[model samples]
Target: MKIRISWWWLPYGILMLASNMWKSALFLLLVLSLHESAHMMAAKAFHYEVPQVVLYPFGFGASILHLGHGSLWRETLILLAGPCVHLVVPFLLIVLVKFDLISITYANYLEQLNQSVLLFNLLPIYPLDGGRILLNFLHLFLPYCCGLWVNYALSVSLVLYLFHETAVLSFQIVLLFLLFQQLLSWLFIKREKEQFYYYRYLSAPKRIRLKHPFQDCFRAFYNVIRFEKEWMQEKAWIRRYFEKEDLKKRKQSHQIML
Candidate 1:
């Protein structure tokens, strides 16, 4: 799909940018834009269509389509591609700075951007790489519902864990924005449950949750860890329906070929 990058993202960013001084805002945009662009390019490389790029003050992201390839590994890799650049860019900048190639004027700023993107994006929230990867991997253990809860659970835990870290610039302020976005996203799911089949499908897909070391350790060692029966039931039924649908789709494809 053809992608559109809105010019308004620049003006809207003023609230974030202007506060950190125009320089901080500018650096923020530069770093986030590069990170998001890497995601777009990776999706395209994998032959998926990307149609929208949304830039925010704290970060920027893209709406990628056709990435639901049904394979846990594929989804995890795709989710990971974005953060790969975040890590790489900072290291390169550090190299340049260390070699006396780049001006020291940006030395502190670059360090902050490096740490910020690494710390922020790595937070185990649903849309974040860590959250996405965790949820997908959780699928192997049982139903999609369980996997989703696992994702949600991990996201929450990760956010809570992040509270102990105090080095990042404006950590609380940025986190508040991220937390607000997450709350609104959850609200969106709740309010539009029926309208969004994908949302429903994600948490309701049928699959067997395998016995991984994580699960074994959690249940065997931590009795406090648990799964919701309602989620498991929903996931079982969804998996069955998906299987039936897939068979029907294949049959249709065969008939067409004949």
Candidate 2:
């Protein structure tokens, strides 16, 4: 897979080294590498093609060639792999330190590094592993459009909360960058409805939760499907009815214009 480092991180790395935090910087890099490697390994194991690995200031990420690749369950496992590695590695470090194979200072550093990686990555913001997991889970129940909207809303909310809690200018700047990145992603998802729908159909047809018979399919096109015991309609049938109703409305509009 193609690998590239963000030039933006170069200055930050230099700053860390110049400030005598070189060991911490090195440990962060090591943890980030392992986390991303875990994702790559999981993708390969699932037979998914990983096209590129990008090294950002915070961490590294591997981009999977998503088209015709893995299922929702497969993707879930892949998404969880990075965090899973973070969960395991600290215990191993502690054991080594306990056995006097490694210094206690080094073990403490590694433990703190791993914990930071775990916490930052587990933030429920889209594009992160945690966010991806939440979105994928939402797609199982909500319509694709609805899931995207909810994801975007959650991202915005978290960004705002972070801004309120932090006085660190650089960290806040990074949060702002993430906010815009998520906004752009939200727009992209909104614009790619057809492609998204097809992928969703293939990956999660059986798990779709929009099983209710609606009074107006057009109005409910982007609505979340809350599972209710009163609704006896199958999701597929409801979706077909919505499609036909949409087509019928378009035809009527065209006839009126003619």
Give me the candidate number with maximum lDDT. 2
Clashes of 1: 6
TM-score of 2: 0.71
**TM-score of every candidate relative to the true structure:** 0.61, 0.71
lDDT of each: 0.59, 0.70
Residue 122, model 2, lDDT: 85
Clashes of each: 6, 0
Model 1, range 1-258, lDDT digits (tens) per residue? 444556766666665555767666666678777777887777777666677766566456788763432556656677777777776776777787899977676876777767877776776787677666666666555444445556666666656566557566667656566667656656664332232224334533244433332211111111111233322333444355467667998999999999
Output the worst ten-in-a-row residue range by lDDT, candidate 2: 215-224
Instruction: Give the lDDT of residue 80 in candidate 1.
Output: 78
Task: Point out where model 2 deviates above 4 Å.
Answer: 57-59, 67-70, 95-102, 191-194, 198-258
Cα-lDDT of candidate 1: 0.59
Candidate 1: where is the Cα deviation over 4 Å? 1-20, 66-69, 91-102, 160-169, 184-258
- Cα lDDT tens digits, model 2, 190-242, are 34454544444444434333434343211113323333435433334346545
